[model samples]
Target: MTSKPLISVIVAVYNGAKTLQHCIDSVSNQTYLNKELIIIDGGSTDGTIEIIKSNQDKITYWESEPDNGIYHAWNKALGHASGDWICFLGSDDYLWKSSVFEEIIPHMIKAESQGTRMVYGQVARVTEDEEICCLDGDSWEYTWRGIIIDGIGSFAHQGMFHHRSIFELYGMFDVSFKIVGDYELLIRVFKEGGNAIFVNGLIVTGMQIGGITSNCVKLVNEMARARRKNRLRVITIPWLISYAWAICFPFLNYIIGERYVRYLVNFGKSSVTYLSYKKNVILEHKNDQ
Candidate 1:
């Protein structure tokens, strides 16, 4: 019988006392048996250390210290991870269910057989109250278009599983990118012809909203930098339009507030939906001829 592969779950946190326990519990509660948990704290002053101490028995290895950023902390954690597959979760993020790891194991096994290096699933963006906002993630087949056209990629890091060999091949995350280092690393993977598999109907993690990713302006700037760094074009129409909107979003939010901004977003989505429906109808008519 083949032994189940060991998986490592790594978390990096700073001043995350309020939510760190949930993150730890989610990993500890996983039904998968062959796994290890590692955590790196950024010298948090908010009782996060106490939480880590209490959960020491469940963690394989952990340390609390000041670090440069999430990527630096992640790079640090990578050294301690001794698993065939590695997954990263934010201090505020939690696995979607106890069966998440169990469910993903088969996919991981299949990926290994096929020489794929990455496997990812959907993530639910949730509010503090646990209300789900939406599912985030897409098929890798469609992911490249957005990465190339918008100068950004959309895979949720919390929901991704990286084969250990990927780091061995591609190196660790770039510590310089304060916001989009994960995206940059992912871009490097795809640019170098790394293969990925996306499992449908698998919701791996529940990500809390209003994290660093909510800073749209900084995210957009870093995304452009990442694209350039990876030798991807940064002058596409979608990229330009997103850059313009990101620059203006803060001012618009300041003047009109988030509610109105949400309204405008919904309106734009509606317009796009209508246009897409009309285009589909025209295509159908032409095809019928």
Candidate 2:
């Protein structure tokens, strides 16, 4: 494996005009230059095409057409990718730092040489008001613990990088799964005896409070289906509770709004996380001197 393998950064979006430019600019400004940016738009009409057009130089391949859902658009982007390695980023997400790829490539090369096919990193969650919170901590370790537990730890797609061959081996994501396609793919990879590397640092910051996946009922149903298809024993307790909440959360959210819900749920944690990260940044800067 080369030190700087070509990495394909695929973004799947719909009506994401407002946040699309940030996503494009982050990839374009990456310190690791050997990458292709592919955008799959699901027939967006809200000025998304213009945003894509304005950033033509940064985008290697892009197309806008009606698709089944996010996973279908992801499959389209995968078809267009020409790089040795691939990673999917949401249209609303971006690399956490300009040097993220530079920090990640060596680990990937090492993983590849050791027969590992996928690599994942930590992600930060960014709120609508721009407050940042690290997803790393006691709740999740940067290891295959998530794979072992099957569905316990964080397995967000935005922070994962994949070697192109995994796709050939596992086939494309189950587009039938509107929300848990990434999890389904991960389960298949592990089931097939493929290995993955975990990079213990933040690579991307994805929007935390919205998207179709936020619909708890759909997510729970799709996850149960994936587990069953893999012949794993399914648990119904959490699913039942989630279904009950999902029934009422939308109405409560409509009355209280997302920002309020987020505030109530995340109250003290986000502030503490923000302060800790700021302190680390200052310490790193001072040590550089």
lDDT of 2 by residue, 109-172 (tens): 9988998887777666667666654363222322333432333223567888888998998899
- Candidate 1, residue 168: how far the Cα is off, in Å: 0.5
What digit string (tens of lDDT, one per residue) describes model 1 on residues 1-289?
Answer: 1358899999999999999999999999999889999999999999999999999999999998899999999999999999999999889999999999889899899999989888999988777888776776777755544554445444578889999998998899999999899989888888745568999899999987667866877888899899888888887655665567677778887898654553454344334334444665799899999
Per-model TM-score, in order, reads 0.87, 0.81
For candidate 1, the lDDT comes to: 0.82
TM-score for candidate 2, residues paired by index:
0.81
Q: Residue 100 error for model 1, in Å?
A: 0.2
Worst window of 10 by summed lDDT in candidate 2: 136-145
Which regions in candidate 1 have their CA more than 4 angstroms from the true location? 1-3, 251-289
TM-score of 1: 0.87
